[model samples]
Target: MTLTIEELRAGVPKHSRKMITQNVVEVLNQLSSDHGEDFAEHYKQNLMSMSTVLKSGTYNMKDYMNAVKFSAFRLMDHSDVDSYMLAFPERYQRLMLKYADYGDEQSIRADKISSFVTAYKKNEIVAKVTEQALIPSRILNAPMFQTALNIQMSIAMSSRSDQVRSQAAESVMKYTMSPEVQKIELEVGVKGQDEIMALRTEMHRLASQQQGTIMSGTNTSLEIAEQVILHEIEDHDDIDISGELG
Candidate 1:
């Protein structure tokens, strides 16, 4: 019910008004099943058609960018986008290979760290180094964690483009790619992977030392999902009760 074109504009990173309109329209439609057509209609475009805007070249950079908080690190600098867009090739086939090879290692480290912390919390793994209730904050403050975070920022920034980000993806691809930049990207990715791996190894050592109720990483993730489901159910229940009382 809170959804609206204006709300989406303020919530999402500031961009072209036409783009915000288009993105919000898509978001509301996607949730039409659970939220109802009326809810989706609240943000639906009218008067000026989306097709007209698209033809005019008004575009949104983050059509796939959801505002919902997920278990992933996101970098958000459009101005420095030139640094990241240069990292990807114009062709989808080439893009996949580059990602597979130079994929951000921080994403991997983030998964490991998140699982380790979840287990630590539900299982109450105590750190011998601190001799106190294991604080995830302590681990987060670890030097490696900060470095991993920085690496992800670099990857995110490198994936965006400033020149034609406002234009559609096709328009951006028309520009020429730099060979020297790709060489530098490869060198940077190699060094980053090495550092990321070392940091991950240290974190694994941290996890091994701790005693917990949930030792397995797989089980830890399942537990987290269960917790999310319960929270959502509670929210829906509250909404129903509120409506009934009204």
Candidate 2:
């Protein structure tokens, strides 16, 4: 039932109001099937309209800009986003080749990262990661864990680790220290950062003595698809009580 303003506007032209309502009903049913009744009700209550008050050009940049500003604000002032690309050049190159249809680089990068993070926040990421766990090769090879690997490598080798950590700690020292954990916290404001930081610290503290191989490279298309499958499976389980498995 929920959609972006642009999506809502697009749907309005293609479908009638009643059709929309029915469609929303079906969607809510499906959501309920996956997320439980409580979540379904919550989502229905929060269903949003796509209409917006625009100032001149179309396509409201409010939310998009907010995300960008948030990322920029939390990120090191002089930190190079390109560094991620440099560290994992092949992954970026492959993405450029695969996503050629999307001409905007920044848009592509933002979409890619946001999609991953959003799914992670929704608990979809865990399913996906678990699914990856199912893939025997990924668990054994390590390279299959591209996104996580990249983040791990970036943090392990970051020149601004101390600087980044200091700023991040100021924003959230009580949480944890893992980048994956910290990145999400930065989105929810300062307090969230602390919580994530504390989580990160705990993660490392527990793993400190363990010398397991860490994923340390960029993500690949196959890896992305794998994660998506995992997300779907997790979502499927979350909404369907009968679908739960051991």
Candidate 3:
């Protein structure tokens, strides 16, 4: 039986239903044909599950749909590059063209596959895939991390330039060592001059009131000072600081 768009998009929210474009339906049907009905159904469920993370408002509809397409391609067994290219010429061409400026053909292909794999591994869909495949998530990401470390090691050991090698070695140490404590600096400022002045006036009034009540005696030095401050503030009542305070 062929999978229909309605069936593939069954659990998606109504408002976001249109995001499952025709291209997405075509990919899902292809999965059903090539991987079997059960695998394709599971893939659809995984894609739907990603909507939970998508609700964060970070991703738009296009990004969500692209992630769905990218994840679908990654899940498929595309071990033979030539055969996979033959099967999906457009996808192959697009990826090749996108990474054309990076390096040679082989490197470009590696970079393309690595990008897709990285996206698949980082996305929330991997959490669902991990649960179903019963593989540790760390294990899935292990190779990529190792690849990064290998590149850094190569640069640190073989680079002839002292500055570059020193920088690479420092990066390796920074990554492998315990991370340094990050200092977060926050800046706070009153938005308006009037507000700042009003706040200062309010603080002064409170301080004066508190100083007045601090002494037990009715006519102590502190009491007299407080009374004088209160009288001065009262004399300036015509300035109308209340509106700014509020």
Report the number of the highest-lDDT candidate. 3
User: lDDT score of model 3?
Assistant: 0.52
Badly placed stretches (over 4 Å) of model 1 are: 32-63, 66-246
TM-score of 2: 0.19
Cα lDDT listed for each candidate: 0.31, 0.35, 0.52
Shift in Å, residue 59, candidate 1: 9.3
Give every collision pair in model 1: 84-158, 84-159
The candidate 3 region of ten consecutive residues with least summed lDDT is 237-246
* Cα error, candidate 1, residue 106 (Å): 29
What is the lDDT for 42 in model 3?
Answer: 59
Cα lDDT tens digits, model 2, 160-240, are 333332333333323223444211111122234454344455435423212121123344323322331111111111111
What's the distance in Å from true for residue 136, model 2? 46
Please count the clashing residue pairs in each candidate, in the order shown. Answer: 2, 23, 0
The sequence of per-residue lDDT tens digits that candidate 1 reaches over residues 89-201 is 13323434445544454553243333433343242111111121122333334445444444433322232332121122222223212333211111121334545444434
Better of 1 and 2 by lDDT: 2
lDDT for model 1: 0.31
